[model samples]
Target: KKVELVTQGEATELDKSLVEKITDPLTHLVRNSCDHGIEMPADRIAKGKPETGTITLVASHQGGSIVIEVRDDGRGLNREKLIKKAREKGIDAPDTMTDAEVWNLIFAPG
Candidate 1:
C-alpha cells in the first residue's frame, strides 16, 4: 500500500516566479510526509489509524497573500521526544516549555 495525496486549492493563481520558488520546498515537504512524518502501515494499524496515510497539499489566496499548507495523517510530532532530543543536543529545551515551543525545536541547529 502507498500513501495517498489529496490536493486542494491548486486552482488558485499565483505569480509564476513564486510558484517556481516554492516548488523545491513543497517537494521536500511531501517527501518528509512520506519518509519521516507518516508511520508505516503496521505501525499505523497498531495506533488504530487507517493503514493508508494521507498527505494534503493546499495552496490558496489568503488575505492578499499566497498561502500554502502541507498536512499529513501520521504518527505526528512528540513533544517529550523533541524536548529530550533538544536537551541531548545541548539546545536548551526547558521542561516548562509549551508544546508549540517544543515543536519549534526542529528548526534549531543540532
Candidate 2:
C-alpha cells in the first residue's frame, strides 16, 4: 500500500533537546497512522479515496511553544471502538456525551 507523507513547517527548527524528547513519541504516532489509523487498501478504494493515505505533520510556533501536530487522512480513531472499550473498562462516559468527549476516553487512566 502507498502512504503519502505531507510535512508542513519543515523549516521550523526546535532545540535539539526538545527534538530528542519528542522523537520517539512522534515516531510512534506515525507508526500508528500506518498501522491502525489508515484502513486497508481495499477499504480505501471502497470509500472512493486514493489508494495512498496521507499522513500530515504540521508545525507552527504558538506563543513561546512550538505546536506540532500529527494527523492522517484515513479512517481516524474509531469512535465506536473507543466507546466500547470505555464501557468494558468501566470508564464513566455516557453515550449522550459529545463525540469529542468519547474520543478523549482513550487518554484516560485505567
Compare the candidates by TM-score and give the number of the best one.
2
Clashes of 1: 0
What are the Cα lDDT values of the candidates?
0.89, 0.88
Every model: Cα RMSD to truth:
1.7, 1.5
Q: Tell me the tens digit of each residue's lDDT in model 2 across 1-110.
A: 67999999988889999999999989988998898888888899999998889999998898988999999988877778888889889887677878889878867877
Q: What is the overall TM-score of model 2 with all chains considered together?
A: 0.89
Which portions of model 2 show Cα errors greater than 4 Å? Answer: none
lDDT of 1 by residue, 1-110 (tens): 46999999978998899879999989988998899788889999999999999999998887978889999998789898898899899888889998889889988886
Q: List pairs with backbone clashes in candidate 1.
A: none
After the best TM-score superposition of candidate 2, give how far the Cα of residue 12 lies from its true spot, in angstroms. 0.9
Q: Among these predicted structures, which one has the highest lDDT?
A: 1
Where does the lowest 10-residue lDDT sum fall in candidate 2?
Answer: 91-100
Weakest 10 consecutive residues of candidate 1 by summed lDDT = 101-110
